[model samples]
Target: MALGLFWATVSLVVFLLISTADMLGYLKPKNHFDVDGKTVVVTGGSQGMGRALGKLLAQRGANVVIVARDRQKLEAALKYISAAAKDVEKQRFHYISADVTKSEENIRIVEEVTSWNNGNSPDVVWANAGGAYSELFIDTPVELMRSQMDLNYFAAAYLAHATLRSWLRPASTKQTSEAAAAVAPRHFIITSSVVCFVGLAGYSPYAPAKSALRSLADSLRSEVRLYNGYRRANPSKGPAADVEIHCVTPGTIFSPGLDNENKTKPAVTHILEESDPRQTEDEAATAAIKGLERGGYLITTQWLGSLLRAGMLGGVPRNAVFMDTMKAWLTPVIWLFMQPDLEGKVLRWGEKNEVKLPQ
Candidate 1:
């Protein structure tokens, strides 16, 4: 008992030291850019969280451009975003109607936006267009699975690739050196879901697609770092466009998409996923933007989402906070001990309910 007490005390002291250091900003990464007056592009900006982000960014003085497939929705979003602009004359909001799932369409949209900004590339691109449908993997058609992947995974990938390519263009282009000097750090944000980390029974089709997005975000983060490093080393040629990639893993959000998803979602899946408190679209957007401002690689809106992010760990980099990392490492052990109870809940739910396929 004495030996155990001694070890506990040592552990507590070590944790305190790490936590204090992290809180003192010794472990945090530098924020390379600010959003003020920057050109920001958001996909799926027709409604929900995308619309919220567009409005918020516009209000903060960003020249916001929103893209969506529905022209009417896009126009409506533009009006909402325009109303939120701090300076109507200086901060312009544009809306483009295009299907993000098509690679060619995404490329075209990026090119047009660049042209509209007078050859200036967007400083931030938020890939927020994705949908989810909860159904058993076996009951889901291949077409549905393919559609989900196309929308959730490939859309973000195509947008990121196109935007990065434009941002990394030769510095001798139309952008003046003065503009380059004031350039905000380029950012690519992908809207991945908490489902990416925790796969429930009915979300098999949707979860894998979100998981693919997480993988894409991870790869893009590493690649962007390397690209920025090379540009920095060869500064004589042009300015370095440092791009930061972030993945947002939001828990349940109160949005139109969620409402539609819940219609088809299974009861057992709801029991598992709906355990966390749901966030409004505006609240989620606010949290996501705050995370980006803090230069976080993995952003979560809720405590449950953050805990899941840390617990899953996988190949993603650790959060800048030392206490957060410690919590993440310890969560898996807690999860192991709680597995029986969790499984029992699922078993009981399964026994009481039946999942029916659509006719």
Candidate 2:
């Protein structure tokens, strides 16, 4: 009887494991996220993950548009992306030099893209332009606080709002119900950070802005559905395509940005950060694209990022309901120790360093 009970428990565990894997997309067919023949716009495309995303989309047969402030880098990136095109002769690639941190510029970017796409909005837009400035909260300059928010949160928000408006504009002539229903879905992707979920010290100037992005994505995902329903209800009026909002939480991406951030990053923050294994921008972009293909709403590019996401997933849409729930349930149990350990490390570092800010 005892042996039967143990075997039964083992079988149940195996079944659960299989179901979790299937639910989390390991066993599912990846039929979604098809970008062939689509137009994609990626901001921050001059460098880092944005550049990688553009190159990958080009490889996937997309007409790629890369946006950045540096015309030279944008031109260089365009050549590299254009080279990866699935159809060199047929596919098109372009770059826009714009400062997305300004709301007006974000709006202009959409207009420019619309013109370039023959009065049609790009099929996909990624708000990937952002920066990180690390400092102790008290030590961070007041001016720097606002600048960080501008670069990290408001830039993405500005682009998202502007592009969404363009994507949702009504057709010049009312579309037939059937035509509206048949329209392809448009995606707006936002880039956030794993630190947004589990913040580290010395990221004072940056983490909250990233956290705001995660929050914004959660709200936008639900909000976009209203338009999806609106189109289904009154197909003739407008919004020819359905809208989907996706956010990616990437762990430390090895890029020029990381190198720049390290110059200002604190020793304690560095110590805390070492737990995450670094990934290059290309690897991060690849992982994020895979998650997007799986239709994950709140996606993470690494195991630790996934764990952090599971812990703080309050009312956000789940990638896989059962898997996310189980992981969510398990996270707090691990955090019981993790929380204290992290706090203790901070306390120890503080005591040893006698941290102080200038008066």
Candidate 3:
């Protein structure tokens, strides 16, 4: 009798979950990004979204700077941005060659760009330099995981620290009394991976690194707000200020890396295959700019974007409740429970939030 009763309750709960998902339109698609007239810098701008974003920003009348470890790639990116810029004569196009993983190199890049801008720092900095290679946890080497974290998370933190001062500085002192105007000079954009949301067997290294970044963004957002509050209290010497920080998560776009993976990985291996033809570089950039301009907290492609938002905002309601109920309601059958890894198939990335600019 008890066994039949348990089955009845389980079936009822499952039915409710399915019904909820359908009613909420969980599978619907949408686009949410916006960027316009912002002075922007992109790390790892040689190729992929970094290069794509640079061109889009330039076309929108932004002063765009391309930074990468390869001088040739940086030069090439600059050429592309210059060609795409709306008003080539009015826009400022610049490039810097630096390896962001090295702290000193990042510091030098910040200094160089600041000096070149007549000491005024970039308004938006996009830290898009990251790469992930899939490997099993037991097979993964320790150093590889460290390198991933260093490049994806630490490097971004380092660059933000180096540029924070100039980035948050107040408007020009040389301007006439009437011309003096406040400026929100600092805005940071980070390219974090969708792997941050779900876990899989072979995603040990990459997932953790990406997850760490989400935490970093959350912490940084709080710190910036606290600092802004402090400035408001002691306003005598400080300049007017605001800083905005945005973390952009994108779905799999067809890049060289993804292309290579598609060829190597078996087609039947995963339920969610790489996106068809992936988003073109130009398309992804255009989408991203749209997200920034709209001030999106989580910028994403339509399909996967909705899934992530749902997950963050009270996902797994049925599963959470079911497990708890099982433990209490079915204590005798507790041994039958197994932690099932239903890795989410939706591929989405990006989170955006406001932060204070440095003074």
Question: What is the C-alpha local distance difference test score of each model?
Answer: 0.83, 0.89, 0.64
lDDT of 2 by residue, 290-320 (tens): 8988888899998888888999988887887
Comparing 1 and 2 by lDDT, which wins?
2
TM-scores, all candidates, are 0.89, 0.94, 0.72
RMSD of 3: 12.1
Kindly give the stretch of ten consecutive residues in candidate 2 with the minimal lDDT sum.
23-32
Q: How many backbone clashes does candidate 2 have?
A: 0
**Candidate 1: deviation at residue 254, Å?**
0.5
lDDT of 3 by residue, 1-359 (tens): 99999999999988678556644756333422223455678897888888888887877778888888888877887898789988877778889988898888778877887777777666677888877666655555789878978887888878877766655454454333223224443677777766676565456767787777766666676667765664455444344455666666666776765664444332222434343224777777776676666455445544454344335523212212332343334432321331131223322211232322334
Candidate 2 local distance difference test against the native: 0.89
Q: Give Cα distance to truth, residue 19, candidate 1, Å.
A: 3.1
Off by over 4 Å in 1: 1-14, 17-33, 173-183, 238-240, 354-359
lDDT of 1 by residue, 268-294 (tens): 777765557899999999888878867
